[model samples]
Target: MRNSRPIILFPLLCFLSSTISILCEPNTLVCNEKEKHALLRFKKALSDPGNRLSSWSVNQDCCRWEAVRCNNVTGRVVELHLGNPYDGFDLEFYRKFKLGGEISPALLELEFLSYLNLSWNDFGGIPIPSFLGSMGSLRYLDLSYAGFGGLVPHQLGNLSTLRHLDLGDNSGLLYVENLGWISHLAFLKYLGMNGVDLHREVHWLESVSMLPSLSELHLSECELDSNMTSSLGTISEVHFTALSKLKVLWISGTSLSFHVNSSIPTSGSGRGFLSGIVDTAPNWFWKFASYIVWIDLSNNQISGDLSQVVLKNTFIDLSSNCFSGRLPRLSPNVRILNIAKFILGTDFPFHVQKMNGRSKLEVLDVGLCGA
Candidate 1:
């Protein structure tokens, strides 16, 4: 008891001092000077009628600015998330929060910017800045639904470190005439180019094949032609082993040749039958699609059986297609099946029995299937 009181008091005092130090810390860390200037320059270039950028000012740290995130340790800008977050309650919110302006090249000053999302804004139909391609450290780049019109800068392919790139839904304005440059993105995993005009890109498939690390691909409504008829003959046997990492593929609304339940005849000397669509028919396609978790081939002219080749534990959408014959065999882990308007030529009783047994199917849309 002689010194216990003094020891307890000393420990309490140390704890209080540490607590006070942490509590007195600044609310937001100070951002880098050059990055702050770059952001201010970007604000000056934009027309923010809704005062969306009011928080951005010289009096405040740029790290605390709206749609900006900086690394706490280094005070370097790491993310710029500007524009309407599409929450789906209000589709027109993009119009309200749309920042209309010329994208300032001053953004190049943020050397550490790894994530930049300018989606759902209004850029006045300008071509995407080619300088963005020089940002080698960028991991996520999304300019979707931003009213960007004109040729997509081939320089974007220079982002070899990019993991996710979404330039989708620009209202048929963006076009990539040459896709060979995309081959340079060796580390790319996810790509969404929905609604972009790719009708003229004959080599899109071949170019995409070069990306060995691609896991998810979305090219819906791109107006791609069904010109793989000649190649289909040779494709069945050709080992597409390089696309082993593909997990999600969406080709809805494209004009690709899809063989449904019918077997595709091959012309080569060692000819064999191709069972179904490219997702399952070709030996390579089926092998690579083993890990596919999502697949949407809706609203296409595909006529195929839902049997042998469909991926397990996947959200499958084969609606509005010419898919006939037997109801596709639902995998044990199939979670959702949208087979609406699918003309499956199977007895109603047999189909219902199979559907009823799938306990994992959380959503089953078999509407308008002429069973």
Candidate 2:
């Protein structure tokens, strides 16, 4: 009865003040003037597709803009992804722009940037400069599926912080050599190089020995040679042994013999031992591989047992080459599998039965042995 209005109204006033403070916070995820201007410049440089970047208006806060990512803690823009296509032009419109242009260094101005994925863009003739590597904060750099050419500047090695590097499918990635230094990347989590000029030497893989934190590695279509094949001897024993954090492996290990239960296939080179050593090389390979689900050695000189290990969520491809082990029970979740040029000598001394569990199998082809 004694002026209850004052008590109710006082709390309401405090709640309203707190809301206004949050909205006007100086540390909010709003773009500063320089960042907004940088965004405007980028929009002008790109040929927007489906008006996707139409939302990139100057009135908008860049951190909230499309395809743009920001560091959640500091509220600073970090990633700028622009690659679709304009209304009228070659589907490769983005490709043409990379051929020749002044890369706005304004982007490098972002202080907290770490991951930059500029793939599928036609950036021809543009060079990966030393300044780009000095991005002391960068951890993942993916310049793949692009047309950039020229020697990979040695400065890239300076990015001591880089963890995942993908220079794949680039026409000129082969130009850079003496990459044993790249092994210096101690924090590398993933490294992919398809159609590049790195084979065997081992000094590079030896460099991997230095990276104790590495997790994933993909060296596809490298077209290995005798030296490269022999390098596997040191893979598990040396660098691979050090990868205590490794999880996935897509490698063709040393040739071994198989326990065939029937006549060997004539189409096969018959060099495979069918001794699944995927778990042998390094203890690390097997340790993390226990958690893997995807592995492919389809077109290679790989021969071994496919069912020796109980790999979960795996899609194994041991076609083309000679593989002589009996197909083991696979998880129903496996989707793709091929064992065409596969054979287990002339005797499978062990059992071959279906594994019991909730799985999803997609492909199963077994041929070439006694076929």
**The candidate that achieves the highest TM-score relative to the unseen native structure:** 1
**Candidate 2 positional error at 130, Å:** 2.9
- Which portions of model 1 show Cα errors greater than 4 Å? 1-24, 86-92, 227-240, 258-290, 306-310, 343-358
Model 2 per-residue lDDT tens digits across residues 137-208: 888788776655666667777788898888766753444555666766778888776655455333556665
* Displacement of the residue 40 alpha carbon in candidate 2, Å: 6.2
lDDT of each residue in 1-371, candidate 1, tens digit only: 99999999998999999999988987657899989989999899998877889999998889998999999789899999985665324757656677878889898898899999988887878888999999988999999888899999999988889999999988788988888888899999989999888755666777788889998999888866444344433333232456678888887876445343333344321211122233224334544554678888776655545455545646888776664455555567888878787644445322532533436878888787674
State the local distance difference test value for candidate 2.
Answer: 0.58
Weakest ten-residue segment in model 1 by summed lDDT: 268-277
Q: What is the lDDT of residue 193 in candidate 2?
A: 67
TM-score against native, each model = 0.81, 0.68
Give the per-residue Cα lDDT of candidate 1 at 13.
100
Clashes of 1: 5
